[model samples]
Target chain A: MKTINKFKMQLCAKSTNESFARASVGAFIAQLDPTIEEISDIKTAVSEAVTNCIVHAYKEQNGDIYITVKIFENNKVKIIIRDKGCGIVDIKKAMEPLYTTGGSERAGLGFAVMESFTDKLRVISKVGKGTTVTLFKEIKSK
Target chain B: MECKLNMTDDTLTAELDGEIDHHTAKNVREQIDLEIDTQTPKTLILDFSDITFMDSSGIGLIMGRYKKIKSIGGKVKIKNPSPNTYRVLKLAGMDRLAKIEREE
Candidate 1:
């Protein structure tokens, strides 16, 4: 559990920033020398989390998203994406695959994609407060 | 994202480049839809040869297109997705609806 490196960034919860947030996390985690597949997994999971903030949490309002990446010993990387916006009332329903409150265009597979790509997934939220999604992965050396 | 369209008598082939995420998915969907609506082709082939990364947004894009094309009696074929992108598509069960082909 020794900390190796860490970085944090705060961004606008605009949909355009979704790519930026995921790419920034990918670049930061690149220092750990993750494989190509590992990089893709991390980026996809990060994308899903940030998209949830932009599409569901803020829901047409401006907000801020916080992203933190921590690299620890044993090549484990943990990422936390948080937003101060409308929170989910039913975590179980929200986590269900193809269960999205967004419009028809939304596939509702965000949480499923995040869970599949990472080793650990944790979500905490309050209806009037905010939501936080934390994802952890252990990079296997090539 | 850049989309290149190639059209023949009954097919519209679109070559997409760059990353496919929520940020770019809207524009991508619109552009492809415009072509499909105008051409009314029998088949729509999406070329993913240059897509470096894709997420659930990409899945939504594909699914949306599949529905639109199916409504007009057109089939959607996905071409040359990278292993990572293919994995995302498979996870979303896109393979069942659309044909995925890896170019040799």
Candidate 2:
């Protein structure tokens, strides 16, 4: 039996909406019987990616953050976080652990954390265009 | 975010209540550090019993505290962490950095 679900939302690229995005994704994913640890891991990864889009993708001003969630029948969830703002100049440096552009007292471990939590992570960015982060993870079946 | 501090002999316990994310990390760091510096306790206990939600920024906070307490030859431990928080800590390799004890 294969079931599929898709969700989309346009959020403000602000710190406040970051929470909203994370919570929304968390609640949506909670529909599956994911382990408690798995749920937290996904939430944290989603938060980091969304926060990067909120803070760095639109450094100059607030913009729109689009989050698309797709849940497959195999219980694999894919998250696509998109931003229509300033995109990353160097994708490699951005993905590196401890690589942070803002002096906001962060650990610069956002992408690193996201990579660790999900089964797959991909980032597509174009300067002056936008960035989209695709993350995927399969929930453990009970 | 509201942070309450309690001290007992050699242990400094911090009750962190509210959402711990990028926006609240600055003030939370200051308050936690202030308590550690002022009390100079031999062990620091982070009571996350009341925390509702946390993000990667929370990892930064915990890591910063670990560094602070380690520099002073003090140990760090967590108590009553919610299931969600426990997961975040595990993903960040925080369990190895500090000891965790379940609270009943």
Candidate 3:
């Protein structure tokens, strides 16, 4: 697919880096001239996806998290978050709101939040392999 | 994230600043929980006048605190949430669990 602009980053799957991941994505997408609300939506979705990798993917160890942002000519933004850690056993159940494997402390709203904030969301995972999440958003033109 | 807790005879008001994400949510929860556990106040108010950003993690933080305070026969209130933060909070159905006070 042809993209007008693209940026990729690789960060360790650490709890402390979740904000950094979101901030980086937000900064990259700013060039699209998105509204403040649009930016907030993107940042929130990125945070959820990155936090999932840190908390669930690498339960006992650290792994690499790959983030790719692509801006198409149509002013659409696509974000891909990938982690090569313990893949999800059940993607269906995992996307359900309030259904979390991370226990009481986790509200299990990560996937739901991402889905709500973006125009499209796709999750693909394989046990013992990895999980990849793709998100799409149509940036409103000013 | 910056958290400041003010304790009255029966109320605990927490002034939170900066962004609230998964990275900062843990610390925010712990700080507030420590005060809630120690004082067992009759009410807990979260002041968000200075909160610049928040996500679903913020929702979880508030919900968790609501559960804790309710268990102790207390209530939770949110004050001075920015328009964006308030929208997110409402979308999470937090208004049903706690009182969301508009800035005066």
Tell me, by lDDT, which candidate is best. 1
Worst 10 residues of 1 chain A by lDDT: A99-108
lDDT of 1 by residue, B1-104 (tens): 89999899899999999999888989989999999999999999999999988999898898899999999998999999999999998999999999999977
| Candidate 1, DockQ score (0 to 1) | 0.83
Best by TM-score: 1
Full ranking by TM-score: 1, 3, 2
Candidate 2 structure quality by residue, lDDT tens digits, B1-104: 78888999999988889878887777878988998888899998888888877777887888888888899999999888887777677766788999988776
Question: For candidate 3, lDDT tens digit of each residue in B64-93?
Answer: 999999999999999999888887787788
- Runs of candidate 2 with Cα error greater than 4 angstroms are A1-3, B69-75, B80-87, B95-97, B102-104
User: TM-score of model 2 relative to the true fold?
Assistant: 0.81
lDDT of 3 by residue, A42-118 (tens): 99899989989988998837799999999998899999999999999999999998888886777788888898899
Residue-wise C-alpha lDDT for candidate 1, range A6-68, written one tens digit per residue = 999999989888888998999998888889999999999999999999999999579999999
Better candidate by lDDT, 1 or 2: 1
When 2 and 3 are scored with lDDT, the better candidate is 3
Writing each residue's lDDT as its tens digit, candidate 2 over A13-127 gives 8787766788899899998988877877888888988888877888837799899999998899999999988999999998877677866466677898889889999999999
Q: Each candidate's chain B TM-score?
A: 0.97, 0.93, 0.97
